[model samples]
Target: MAIFRKPGRSGQPKPTPEPTPGQVAEELAELVEELEEPTAGGPADGGPSRQVVEYEAEYRAERGRRRGATLVASIAKLIGAGSRSAAKGAAYGGRAMADQLMQAAPRIPVRNLATLRAQHPTAADADRLAALLITGASRASAALGAGVGAAAMLPVPPAMAVEIAAETLAVAAVEIKLIAELHEVYGVRAQGNVTQRASAYVAAWANRRGIDPTLLVKPAGLAAMALGAEVRQQVRKRLTRSTLRRLPSLIPLMVGAGIGATVNRRDTRKVGRQVRDDLRSRRPAAAAYWSAAAPALPGETAP
Candidate 1:
């Protein structure tokens, strides 16, 4: 017992000391100081600071405005192109109809009736009377179609779709009636006689336009012709005198195409606006929720 073990060598480990309460308090104070330091460009909490949020809001608003402007401009250009096409189509259709009428007019005996009235008094009186009736009916039908087509081509709002449809139908009716009346007045009373004449007329017009004659004989073809005539007339009325005089020969076709193009454009824009509004109205609430949940301070938990 009196012989104590020799002390450990210098390589032995030393005893550890416990930390004091004062040291613990000092460490806590250092941590608090670090937490209290202001963030570089944000609030102390992790949430976006007021200034940062405001700036972001402004940026987003500006970006939205630019995008909106671009979208509107694109729509306008498309609408303009459509309007031009419709006008042109109508004009061409009218010209075709007119050409057909002019060619057919010579075949009728009325051309000689005018001269006979001053010379032979009663030369081919029955034929002259029949021809007059036929010519009158044809002219009336052509005029009616031209007027309605023109009205449809005007830049009315989309709300007038019903009116436009009515006008288009009216024009087609006039055209069909005119053909029937011409046959009746000319004493072409055979079964399917009017239909045959109509087919021949359509074929002649198609040949002039370089389209399929079969297309011109279809019901759709007649409708198209009437609509086209209307469109052409409208374009002619709208153009400046200088342009009208310069392009007198091509006016009908140009106007019809322009009207069709215009209608397409206007309708497209109307649909686009509706879609934009719907999307804007349907924005998710999640955006607002996330924007509201930002942390108030860098070291604080999100509220």
Candidate 2:
């Protein structure tokens, strides 16, 4: 057996391999290591940043403010310009209409008109009646033509113009009838005495309000006559039991005059403001002079 040992090498088995100490230590270090850096183009804190969003919101707000300011300034300028133009147009139109009415006055019969005081005979009754007629007529005419011309300035449909014209004429007719009847009940004549009295009242009121009284008188008279007729009809219904049918005759005149005073006052103020603005725009350096001197002019502060 000892002699044959060297010859048994062919039956030997292979040994199993074991890990080295250095290899084991390297693996342990890798398992316990912390991340060294973030991935490319990724956020360091791992969430979306708000810098871009905040910047965009701020930019939008600033832009909106600028646009709003521009719009407001434009609107203000347009309104100011329109106001001046409207006032000039209204003045011209009023004068033209008054002249037309005056020319026609001579042909109108005056002696048969009724008076307003026959039914409500009180202090200053005649004056009160005249006041009512003037005021009411002025309001009616002005209202009827309020924005008609303004529409023409715009690019409106053709049909709208016809409609507006027809409506205005209808309203004017009604107002004239009312004024006539009110005068009739008061025993005032439509053509002469009542017209003169009403004109005087209107002139006085216009003087106080700084407007051209002449511009308002005739139109107002026409409107009063129209409204007076309607008022008379209504009074007829209410006064059936009493002796008040005559009351309708005066109501239109009295109401008209009162309304005229109010409208004149308001419109005068509006015109003055526009005039001031126009003057300022045209001559900024002369604004102070105009303000102090204009009111002292004949018709500026007459009323």
Candidate 3:
């Protein structure tokens, strides 16, 4: 398919350049913003508040449907490439996926305490906001999983791979954003440049725990430097496990839909609860949250 190729001077296909980190960050930020924000009328309008998170999830799923053909073509090309690289061993795919995830981790847009309070003025305390965030994220993750599973019914079975990949990244983005925001709510916000703090959250996501205050101050923490080999390996293993867990959702027909949604919701809630519990224990006194947590300024990022 033409979608799988780009013409070159000699009529050979050429690869497209990867997006810059800035571009990826912008894209992810926009996506999360859409998912997190309330409906146009807001809660004050007294409109039909059909689950806002579910509505947003369906929006993304609709977009995925429109791109279904492209997804199939892209996966076709990916599978072909995989066949050619079989000699390199199975670890290659895991490693490459991990690298893409790591590249993405540092770019997730995280709001600080100031932004959270401003956006959610009605929430009087950190715990209140944290509860809302966890519930919304869990529902969103379930919706995304259901959407992907439903897509499996399409004639293009191979496209399940692409669907799974997209779902993984999207769900990860949602959860990582949740973890970062929870930290903000609890007043244990990680200290660093945009990339550094984000990297710490990524580590937290992989580890299935909140950021350790001691680690953030330590020179050996993942936040102290760019993602190292060991950290990347940890991420790879975590992602590998995550991807495998979604494999059952590839079953044809609508059976996968129920399976996918259930698994995703359960996993997301588990992570949220784990991180929330950790943060609750470590959070500083309520009075210190505002003074200690700095606002995340516009266009802030690591060099």
Candidate 4:
């Protein structure tokens, strides 16, 4: 049977396409960068910058719309009024997530020692800056978790899968950035090109420690500088565990929101402390000996 065509209104703008994984990573990186720098003329209290608080509100609002739409469709499905396409779309895998993370890692910007010093001139010691970076990253991560958790009450199972992937990628990006910056703070910047250094940081993220240049396993030949296969496998395992840990945050009612935020904040702080301790142990002595010069801090200009 032939159906009649309906007339459409003119001058309506097209809706924006859903962002790809890479784009999301870039967005998160930009946000982290903004959060890193101290705001001009702001208070000296050392809390999250104005941007961080604003982003949390914006992030929650955006996620609310996405999840709300999905929840309605999900409810329809539970009532036998929707299709199974959503379940299929939610079949995202851990390997794919890891690959996306590896690709996105290099895109995240890490400031050098000179830049960090310039940006934070008041910071008298590496530990001071490290503490600020850790706090900012922790707040950002908590915001992400809370945004996803508060998205819906009794989130649909299929929708929860997608949310888990989004949260995992976002939280990972924030944590990876934290790890890289901590390396900068302690003067242990990884060697190699941008991609190579990022891969090293990703490895550190997987191991939950600072990058030890000597212990790094480089590939052979032309690809020798790239992230090795063994490390990729480790990243996959790490991401899977992280994803699983987020499962409890999908509990019915609004309880999940609090759990997600607290867990993310605590986990990020824990990682920051662990990496800091390792870097501190490997850090060179600041005092100069009579016969020799003390090594300069990472990114510090050598005398």
| Candidate 1 residue-wise lDDT, 179-296, digit = tens | 3322222322113233344443333222222123344335565445434554345323322221222221122433643343233223223322332233233323244432233324
Off by over 4 Å in 3: 1-31, 35-92, 154-156, 218-220, 223-225, 290-303
lDDT of each candidate versus the true structure: 0.32, 0.30, 0.67, 0.67
lDDT of 3 by residue, 1-303 (tens): 245777899998787644454554454444444445444453557754557745865676555333332332333233332444333323335676676666777777777777776666666777787877776677667766776677678533544565576566657777888999898788777776677777788888888998867866554565544557767787778877887888777676977877877888899889999999988887463566664444334786311
The order by descending TM-score is: 4, 3, 2, 1
What is candidate 4's lDDT per residue for 59-92, written digit by digit as tens?
6545533433343233223222224534653566
Q: lDDT, candidate 1, residue 256?
A: 40
Query: How far off is residue 256 in model 3, in Å?
Result: 2.1
What lDDT score is found at residue 24 in candidate 3? Answer: 45
Ranking by lDDT: 4, 3, 1, 2
Say which prediction, candidate 1 or candidate 3, comes out ahead on lDDT: 3
| TM-score for candidate 3 | 0.70
Clashes of each: 43, 45, 0, 2
TM-score per prediction, in order, is: 0.21, 0.23, 0.70, 0.71
- Clashes by residue pair, model 4: 187-298, 219-224
Model 4, residue 45: distance off in Å is 8.6
